[model samples]
Target: MTTLEQLLDLPRFSDLEILSAHKNLERKVESVEITETPDVANFIPKNAIVLTTAMIYKDDQSKMKHLLDTLVSKDVAALGIKVGRFIDDIDQDVVDYASKVDVPIVKVPSSQPLGRLLYQMLSYIWDAKTEQLTYALDIQKRFSGLLMHDVNLSRFIAELGKIINAPVILLSPWHKVISNSQYFSRSDHPASFYIEQIDDHHYDKINEGNSSFIVKDLKGENVQVLGYPVNVDTYFPFHLIILKPEQIPYPVSEFAIEQAILVLTFILFKNYKVDEFFDIMKSDFLSQLIKAKTDQTHDHRNWVDLGSRYGLVHSKYYRLALAYCVPNKDNKTKLIYRQEEAAIAKKWLEAQLPLRIKNVIIFKVKNTNEIALLFQSQEPDANKVLQTLADELKEALSIQLCFAFGNPYEAITNISSSFIEAKSALDEATRLFNPNVVNYYHPKGLVGLFENTNEESIHYYCEKILKDLAYPNDQSQKELRNTLKHYLDYNCEITKTATALYLHRNTIKYRIKQCEKLLGLSVKDPENSLNLRLALELSESGNESSEQAEPGA
Candidate 1:
C-alpha cells in the first residue's frame, strides 16, 4: 500500500506542503478523489486523499470547519487544497482544526490541474501495489530456496531477519529463546527486553495462530512485533517473533514469514523424530542397566553394550540421582500430570546441568514426574552438585523437586546397585526428612542397616528396649518419650534439652530419671542413647508400614 509519506517523495508532488497533522503523514492513501460539492465528504471513501479548491467554503470560515469535521469523521486520509485559486490562504483557525482532528492537510500548487493530480496519485498507488506483489514473490522464492539446503533453524531465522531488515527470535513452547538473529546483539537493548515485554495474552493469541500485533518495549515506546506459531508434529509448539524497527516504513512480508515457519516446522519435526528414536534407545538402556545384577552367571552383555554407547565407561566412578516432583500439600489434587510442565522442566534440567556441572547424563525416567541423572566423578561432590541442580530447577521451573543420590560405584556394571540404593534413599529421605530434601545413601545409618531386617524382629527389639515408651499408653508416657528423644538429639546436654523441650532444667532431669527407671538403664549413657534412637526409628518405620498397608491408604 502507498502511504501519504511515500507519495510526498514523488517528483510530481514535490511542491505539496503539509499544513497540519504532520505526525499523521504515514496515513495510507488507497485512491485519490476530487471533492465537487460541499457534501462530497458523504461520498468520499475511507483512506481516500481528497482534492479540492475550497470553492464551496472560501467565503465562510464556518463552512470550512464543517467540511473539515465531516471529512475527519469519514476517516479520509488527507486533504489537498489549491490555496491560491479558492482563497488567499487557508485560515489559521481551519488549519488548527484539521491538526486537532488528526487530518493531514496539504497545500496543493494552485497552477496544478486537479484532474492530472488525480491521475498521478492513482498511477503511483497502482505502481506501489505492483511492487508489493513482486516483493512478496521474491520473498517466497528466497525463503523457499533456503529449504532446499539442509540449513538449521538458526540459519532460517538469520535469513528472515536479513530479508525484513529486522530482528528475529524463535522461542520454545515455554517461552525460552531457542535461536535469535544477529540483529538482536547489535541493538541498544537485548532481545530479552522485547521478549519480556510481550504479554501472556499475546502468546496465547499466537498459540491459536493467525495473529499479529504491536506491543510496547521496555521503555513503554510502541514497537511493532509479529508472532507466528510453529507447531511441529502436533506435539511441540514454538513462537516465531519478528521485531519491526520504527525506521522501516514497509510492513514485513507475510509470505516470507510463512515460508520461514514452514521450513522451521519441518526441521523441528525431523529433529523430534530422530530424538524420539534416540530417547527410546536410551530408555531401554536405562531399564536394563538398572536391573542388571552382579552375579557372574547372569548375562550382562546388554547393559555393557548400552553403557558403552552412552559414554558410560566401566572404569569411571559413577553416582546416580533421581529427581521427581513434589506436589503442593494445599493443592495435591492439582498435580503436575500434564506433559507440558514436565517437558519444560526436563528440558531446562538437561540444558542447565552441563553448564553448572560437567560429566553428567540426564534422561527421563519414563515417568512424567521423574528424571534420572548419572554423574561420573571420583570426588565426593555429587551430592552438592545435585543440591545445586535441585535449587536451580526449583527456581527456574517454579516446582519443588527432591533429589536422592546413591553411593558412588567404581564400575559401570555396578550401576544397578547404585540405582537400587537411590530408590531406597528416596523412600527413606521422604520419611526421615521433608519430602523436598536432597539426600544421599548412608549404608551405616540406622535406617540403612536394618532396612532389610525382619519386621517382627525389629518390633520385638523396639518394644524390649523402651517398654511402655514404644506404645505410649498415657499422655505422661508420651511426654517422657518426646523429652527423651529431644534430650538424645541434643547430645544429652541438660541445658540444651531443657531449651529444646521448653521446660525447666529440673523438669528435664526428672523426665530423664523417670525414663531411666522405666528402662532400667541410664538414659544419658552413650550405648543406651544409641539404642533408644534406633528403637525410635524402628517404631516410626513400623507405624508407617502399617499405615501404608491399611485399606485405601
Candidate 2:
C-alpha cells in the first residue's frame, strides 16, 4: 500500500507546498484536478481538489457565484486559489461567497508559484503511484514461481489485477478476449468479434518494427484504453497482452509492467518450444515406424517427414503424403530438387485450396526424387485434392507426379499399408500407364489379370516375343512386328488377326507361317501361342528393350 508521505516525497513535487494556514483548517483533500476556467464548479471532477486562479472572473460576483454553484454541484473536495499579480488581496466578496457556499478555498500565495504547486501535487500523486507499483513488482517476483508452474492465465491475471486495483483483460492481436481479471464485467464474446477488430490497417501500428504503446479512446466507451504490443516475432500469428486502467491517480510502474509482459512473453515462447519438440518427436516416431515396417534399406527405399521440412507440424494437423518420380528410358539420374520441388508444390496447393486447409506436410524420400506429403485434414476430399495437386505439379513444376496417398490413418501402424499400396500404384503407373497422376485404387481392374505374373517371367516373355519379330530388313521387321501384335492380340485367330491388321486372311496365315519358321515355334498350339502372346505384349509395351537385342547386331 502507498502512503501519503511517500506521495509527498516524489521529486516531481519537490518545490511545492500546501499552505499551513489551510492545512490547519482540518479539511480533507480527496482527489486532485487541474483546470483553467472559473466555471470549474460546473465541471469539478468527483472527489477532487480543484486547482485554479480567479483570473477568469476576478471582478464578476455572478460568475464567481455560478462557479461556486457548479463546484457545490460536483461535491468538490476543496478549492485551491492561485493568488499572484492578478489578485493582490483575497477578494472579500469571493471569500464571503465561498464561505456562504461552504466551499473550502485554500489560498495559494504569489510568493509560492502556481506551477511549483501543481508540480508538487503531481509529484505527490506520482510518488504514491510509484510505491504502489513497487509493491506490485514485489508481488510479481514472489509469485513468479507460481506463474512459471503452468497456471492458467486467468488466475495469474486476476492476482495481478488485484494488486493494481484495476481490471485486467488479455487480448490477442485480433482483440479476442482470452482471460480477464475480476474487475471486468463480462468475460466472453463471439470469436468473430475479435477477428473483426484485427483489421489489416491496424497491423502496421501493432506489428511495426519492434514494440509500441498507444492510448486510444474507444468510440463507445468513456474509459481510456491503453494498448501494448507484445513482441514475439514477425511470424508469430497471434499477439497477446493485458489491458488495464489508463490514467487513474494510481501510479503506473512502467518497469513493473515491462517485467510482467516479458515474463508472459517468455511463457508463450516456452509453450511454443515445447509444442515444437513434441511435434518433432511425433514426426520422427512415425517416420521410423514406417521405415521399420517396410524394412526399408538406406539404398532402395526410405520414408521422409514432410511436416518437419516445412514447419507443417506447427499447424493443427500433422499430415503429409509421398510421391515418386521414376526415371524413364533406363536412365538412373536421380530427381534433383525433390525436396525443394515438394515445398514449391505445397505452396501451390495452399494457394489453390481453401483457407481452411491450414496444415500440410511435405518432404522428399531419400535416394529417390519422390516427394511425400502428410496431408492434415479434418474432412478430406481425396479426389479433388489429388487432382489439384497433380494439376499444380503439371502446370508449375512441369514434372509428372505419381501421387501415392496414404489412408487418413491417425496412428503410425496403419500408415505403412497405405504407403505400400500407394507406392505399388505409383510403380504400376510408371510401368503400364502415364506417370502424370495415379492413385492406388485406379488400376484395380488390371490387378486380377496381372496378379500371377512374376517379374522374371514377364521380362522373359516380352524379350522372346520381340526376338521373333526381328527381321533382316527394317520395313519387313516393322511389318512382322505389326503382324505378330495383331495375331497375338486376336487370340491366334487368323480371320480376326487379318481383319484387324487390314490384310487378307491368307496374308495373315502366311505371316504366321513365316513367324513360326523364323522363331522355330508352333504358332497354332495354345501353350506355345500363350507364351508368344505374353512376350509380344511385354515387348510391345517397351519393358524388354534392353533384353531384346536386334538380330545380327
- The top-ranked prediction according to TM-score is 1
lDDT of 2 by residue, 229-284 (tens): 56543332234433434432344465566566666666656765774466456556
TM-score of each: 0.57, 0.44
| Least well predicted 10-residue stretch by lDDT in candidate 2 | 544-553
lDDT of each: 0.75, 0.56
Whole-structure CA lDDT of model 2: 0.56
Model 1 regions lying over 4 Å from their true place: 8-17, 27-134, 165-255, 294-298, 325-337, 379-402, 411-414, 420-437, 441-553
Residue 534 C-alpha lDDT in model 1: 88
Number of backbone-clashing residue pairs for each candidate, in the order shown:
0, 17
For model 1, residues 342-427, the per-residue Cα lDDT tens digits are: 55566667777677667677777765456788888664665576677667666544566778888888777677888878877777
In model 1, residue pairs whose N, Cα or C atoms come closer than 3 Å (at least 3 residues apart or on different chains), thus clashing, are none
